[model samples]
Target: MTLYGLKTCDTCRKALKSLDKVEFRDIRSDGIPPDVLKSAYAALGDELVNRRSTTWRGLSHDARAADPLTLLAEHPTLMKRPLITDGTRFFLGWGKDVQADLMR
Candidate 1:
């Protein structure tokens, strides 16, 4: 399984700590290669971009409206944190609810 997010991200850290059973791969440090990021997009759709994030807030309205692929290609930070994937299922963001499911 792969976990795509910054190690410093609170949600990512919490998810990791909460679910000790799973091994995770931090995409921020490993630097998700372009191909992988593209595949993730394909899997998760544009929802991968966290519209509520500070990074998203910094982008212009035009940028937000632009294609997510273009935005992600240019600014990978636009992606939501804790992008967890278990080869088939893709999850964006982290929360207690997800933790419960993941832990189970």
Candidate 2:
């Protein structure tokens, strides 16, 4: 399993603590591969982007109007926290439903 998120994110920290044997990738430093971002967007659609985040709020109108992939590529923090993937599957955020799914 691999977890993609910011290292300083409290949610990501919580997820790392709760989950076992998962590789953590800090999106800010390590950066997300285009293929991985593409796959995430494919699986999660618009939900992958956290429009409610400060990162989103800080974006210029033109930047906000840009494609989701471009937004994420320019600012990875725009992605919702704790994007957990287990090869074939992808999950966005650490919400209750996602937590339940992870438990399984």
Candidate 3:
């Protein structure tokens, strides 16, 4: 299992604490692989971007309108927290459905 998120994010911390035997990758330092970002975009679409985040708020209008992959590649923090993947499936956020899936 692999988890992609900011090391400073509280939600990511919580997920790291809850999920067992998972590898944690901080996107800020390590950066997201293009292939993974592409797959995430395919699966989650615009939902993958955390538009409400300060990073997004700071973005220029043009940047905001850019493609999701471009946004994420430029500003990784724009991505929602704790993008968990089991090398097959992708799950975003720590919401009920995601929690249930992780708990399985």
For each candidate, the alpha-carbon lDDT, in order, equals 0.74, 0.93, 0.92
lDDT of 3: 0.92
Residues 42-61, candidate 1: write the lDDT tens digits. 98786887788787899888
TM-score of 2: 0.96
Point out the worst 10-residue segment of candidate 1 by lDDT. Answer: 20-29
| lDDT winner between candidates 1 and 3 | 3
Model 3: what TM-score? 0.97
Q: List the residue pairs that clash in candidate 1.
A: none
**Model 3, backbone clash pairs (residues 3+ apart or across chains), number:** 0
TM-score of each: 0.74, 0.96, 0.97
**RMSD to the hidden true structure, all candidates:** 2.4, 0.8, 0.7
| Candidate with the larger TM-score of 1 and 2 | 2
**Would you list the clashing residue pairs of candidate 3?**
none
- Per-model tally of clashing residue pairs: 0, 0, 0
Off by over 4 Å in 3: none
Where does model 1 exceed 4 Å of error? Answer: 21-24
Residues 35-66 of candidate 3: C-alpha lDDT, one tens digit per residue: 99999889888899998999989999987898
